[model samples]
Target: MRSPFDLSFRLKIPLWGSLLIVVTTLAISTSMMVQAYNDVRSDLVSSASSLGGTLAQTLFPAMLHDDVWQATEIIRASLHGGRESNVLRPELVFVLDREQKVFISSQPQTLPLLADIRQRGEEYRRLVDWIATDAGLETRSLELAKFHRIYVATPIVDTGAYLGTLVTVHSKEALLARFYSVAWRGLGIGLVVLAILLPINWFWGRRTAVPMVQLTNSIVDMAQGRASHLLPQNYTHRDELGRLFEAYELMVEFLQDRARLEQGMIRAERLAAIGRLSAGIAHEINNPLGGMLVALNNFRRRNGQDERALATVSMIERGLHQIHEIVNAMLVEAKGKARDFAPQDVEDIHQLLAAETRKCQVTLQIDSNIERPVPLRATLVRQILMNLTLNAIQASDRSGEVRCTIHIAGDQLLLHTENGGKTIPPEVVDHLFEPFVGNRESGHGLGLWIVYQIVTQQKGQISAESRGGVTQFTVNLPLGDPA
Candidate 1:
């Protein structure tokens, strides 16, 4: 078990991002819902006041003339459903005369005309008590919510005549229903916004977290001495994370290159030690062989008369000569015989590699810009060309192209081989010419090493590059006098 801090940013970031989005959405949605409900509630209150005032104006002449028919008509006309307006219509509206009796009401059955207003219900009695407490010539409101209605008392008068009061009872149920409608509508819109935004938020969060996770994994792999996966770089994003990713990539490259360089130096040092020992051994064997050959010649000159002895001596001399030749090869360059580099040598290599290319179903392109023989060691140069071309062919995909190009670059013979193949890591490429660096079953990894030795011995340069699905090897050997 480990702390939550050990959790990968890849997983953590998306989870946290989703949570943040939900919280923000809820906050915004609740605020909007509250605001919407208040707006509708304000409109409801305004409608109650407006309806009360309008009814009072209409009922003014009715109250003065005792026209109950006109008063009832006015109250009935004011009753409207939710669809008719943004605010709910008043549930119960009625007119009161100066005697505090119910003159007219929309609900005539429950509230009889010309009845004492206070004696009808306890709610009415409360309204009457309120009127007596504050006798004013203006529209007033009383929110009797516990009684499930609001009492708006609007005074009726014509030119300062104390006519009557127009009291409208608005039900709490209607007011609440309108508020619920506004709240639901606001909530529906908020849900729609959440539906659209949530997925996008999640996806964006995942997109951002993916790269960070990959980068973190890469660092872990590098620390554990494993091949790191390549990060999906977003150079277009110039954020902090993007910069960090870029920096990490550059750091990895630098470290790999440094490691390769160090490995190459170590390999070179080992090879130098081996070369020194080999040269010494060759010299030691050569000195004894020269003395033995001289002694054998003298013995042959003195015993020529004995036919059997002479025949046996000749056979021994021939064996010694073979040994001498082998030693000579080991001492200087490993070649049957030395020859100058020529254009025909390129054709010979092409002929050899063509058979291999055919077997792999790969295309081999050999281009030589040589018009005549070049002053270089034919054996080693051909070996370098053959090895590089073979490696290119092996690296290429089936039906892919392995291109070999040869030409004279200044005073040096240049050999270039290329193939469309898997990219070689910079670390592998750096010490590629060192012995046993990329040792595998297919090769002893001595091909490039031998090539490197020959080039360095000939005062030449050789390098390799792999990029953009293309891997290339280039060798340059200085033109020499007859070997």
Candidate 2:
């Protein structure tokens, strides 16, 4: 709910991935089925050609000798028809002479002596047309595909002399039967492939999507200011998704750092506002206190003879003086010095932390390259550095490294301090800079409250993070106070 742009990757990946696989498989299966159909149909044509050529050779002697009985017997025997109507066989056979008169016929009654050959049927009319137009010696084939029948016309010749033609009719219903068988096999194969592959696809698709779902949930948690400890399960590849996991981790760390900084800025602003309000109240009270003290002195002088009145006047004067002192103290504290931050201030903090670092045996590396007096409060800057450096030194183990870097970038002065130590928990890091929130068991904190105060007063920002065995703090202070 924290992120509105969440995706249902778990459902989407498998649903779409399976769809893609099924579509691709079905396309491949369809292509294969079509090819099978062509093969079966081609086999029918080839059968016709081979059978007709043989019949032409067998009928050659019958025609040369004018033996019609032998040709008729050859035609009937070549049909290969079974007693059952469902048997696959040649549907018709005929031996016709060059004069377009049938010499022999399987269907003797319907196509008696070829009965002018062209008048047998509309399909045969087209068939004879093709055969008659061709050079008489060459073999030709006619396909009446819509009727599921084919005709192969082969010439019966004697020493290049034109003789009768042997025409064999083959049925493609047999091819359809074979194609249906192939299609069923293909369907079974496709179903088996889907049965095996779809589950794998579903499993792997969901597996791949798991990381994306976790990333989404992690984003939601981050948006709501919750720490996301989302480490992808066994995710170490350099693929696109792997890169995304790496990027997500980096993004989570970046957001955590930003959140800490913003929290620090907010707390500092609140404290700074409270300080300003207190100062304003002190100034307002001080203006009236002096007048009352003056009037008390004048009244005590005039009522000098009345002991009770004078006593009351003296007591009233003492109370006014006490009030005056308190107001003066508040006013003085409020008017902080506007000394510009200088390079020496960094050195002073380094010197102050040197003995502590030595005692802890921690290496303190300071990188302060500025030579000019920056337009920031020197005392406040020094205080922040001292507190951060001192705390880093204390947190670091023996022989551990503590680094502090200070530099100026454009309108702001940047400070970064870090220590190699145990990772501070998220709960502690949330309020690390808050007043009275103790990071260490022995103390309320590393003068972070004061650092927050300084940054807030300067209208700046501070953020801290403790993770990966490294505790770090960053502060950005405005170089010049706003008018």
Candidate 3:
């Protein structure tokens, strides 16, 4: 399952943007609804208070003269007046004397239940008492039967003569209906706005998401070595993604240039190593050639079935064979192909380095315990051994022994070379296998570096250490299937 934290930019940006728009829209709509509700309630209370005050003023003259019929007609007219105006119509109107006695009512049938107002609750009693005390017009909300209503009470007075009280009850159903109407209109507008904004948000999101997705895909392709170039047309925008694409192009170009340079350096180093090896091989061959020339000259002097002549010819043949073997080995190493390592390859290296060791007056020792053919490139193995043996011989003191050992451990082949010589300095040992690093003035320093490259290329490791008046090099090659 994909992690929630791994959400792509395409989804994350659009999701959050939509959510923000929705939340803001909802908040605005809700606020409008609340304000509309309060406005409607306020209008209802104001209309009730205005209608009650008007009735109190209209009924004052009739109440002072005790004209119950006139006061009733005035109350009925005021109640019916609301029907023609955009004000909450009163459901009931009651005229009560200062003694809290009902004298006139718009609905005569409710006159008997006016006395039940005192038994209803403290809120109604307080409202009635407040009006009787001439505390100005007052409004209160109460549930009557199944409908909630607002009551507005006003005092009826004639020249400070406390005539009676005028009470008007307005049903809250109309107020609630108006509130709902405004709320639904607001909701409709919000929905329309949301519908229009959603598409725009989606398009905007796609504009950002598509480019980022393309850039991501391109990066993935580059990482997998499937894409070598990016098109400028795809990232033409003046944005961060465009900058990233340009950066990626520059990086790829740099990498390609660096790769080419490294390849050239490696080739140059290999040629340099080959040149050094050729010089050593030429020296080895020159010595044998000198000996062979002497033998040939002696054979010619003792010709015609002489035993010394036969031995001299045999000696010349052996020298020619040795030269041929060394040349063949050099040719093989130059080819640089993976091949099984035979015991003869090891012997060939010893013979190739014989002249160099002899010239240095170093005693070279070969200790071989390899019974099975090693699964490795013969050329690389020979090069590694040759370089180590040469280095050992060069490092050893006069008449000091240089030992080369080959053995198998587990499924790996180990080649080790040690020479009895002055311990190598710590500074030189630190970068011993690096290119152009060597102790000898005549050395170009590419020999051990080439050895290191070959060993690593064959999935092997090479290490060197110097201690106790001896410098040693060890190479471990895995005997596994070729990669």
Which candidate number maximizes TM-score? Answer: 2
lDDT of 2 at 214: 81
Q: Give residue 316's lDDT in candidate 2 (0 to 100).
A: 85
lDDT of 1 at 255: 83
* Local error of candidate 1 at residue 155 (angstroms): 5.0
Inter-residue clash pairs, candidate 2: none
All predictions: root-mean-square deviation over Cα?
8.5, 9.8, 17.4
lDDT of each: 0.79, 0.79, 0.76
lDDT of 3 by residue, 1-483 (tens): 997558887887787778888999999999999999889878777777777777778789898888888988888777664355454777778887866777788877646533645654765576565565545434344344443667777778656666767788776777777888899899999999999998889788877887788778877887786556775587687677788888888878987788757854675566457556765776777676768767677766764767876776777778787766544433323364667887888789889999998999988999988665677767777878888899899889999999999988888999999998888897787666666678888766667766866676566777778999988898899886642
- Each prediction's number of clashing residue pairs: 0, 0, 0
Model 3 ranges off by over 4 Å: 1-6, 81-87, 111-116, 120-147, 158-161, 213-234, 259-271, 290-294, 297-302, 305-483
What is the lDDT, from 0 to 100, of the residue 111 in candidate 1? 85
TM-score of 2: 0.60
lDDT of 2 by residue, 1-483 (tens): 544235487978888888898999899999999999878767766777777778888888888889888988888787655555432357788877887788888988878874787777887778778877876676677888777776778888868887878887777776677788899999999999999999999999988888878877877887787868676464677899888888888987898889868865676666666557657887889778878888777776773368887888788888888777655543323246778888888888888888999999999999987788987778778878888888888899889999999989888899999999899999877767555565777654426766776676677878888889999999998878622
Model 1 lDDT on a 0 to 1 scale: 0.79
Alpha carbon lDDT at 3, candidate 3: 79
lDDT of 1 at 240: 93
Cα lDDT tens digits, model 1, 92-180, are 78888888988888898888888998887888888898987877777788877669777788888777887888877777776677778
Evaluate model 2: give its lDDT: 0.79
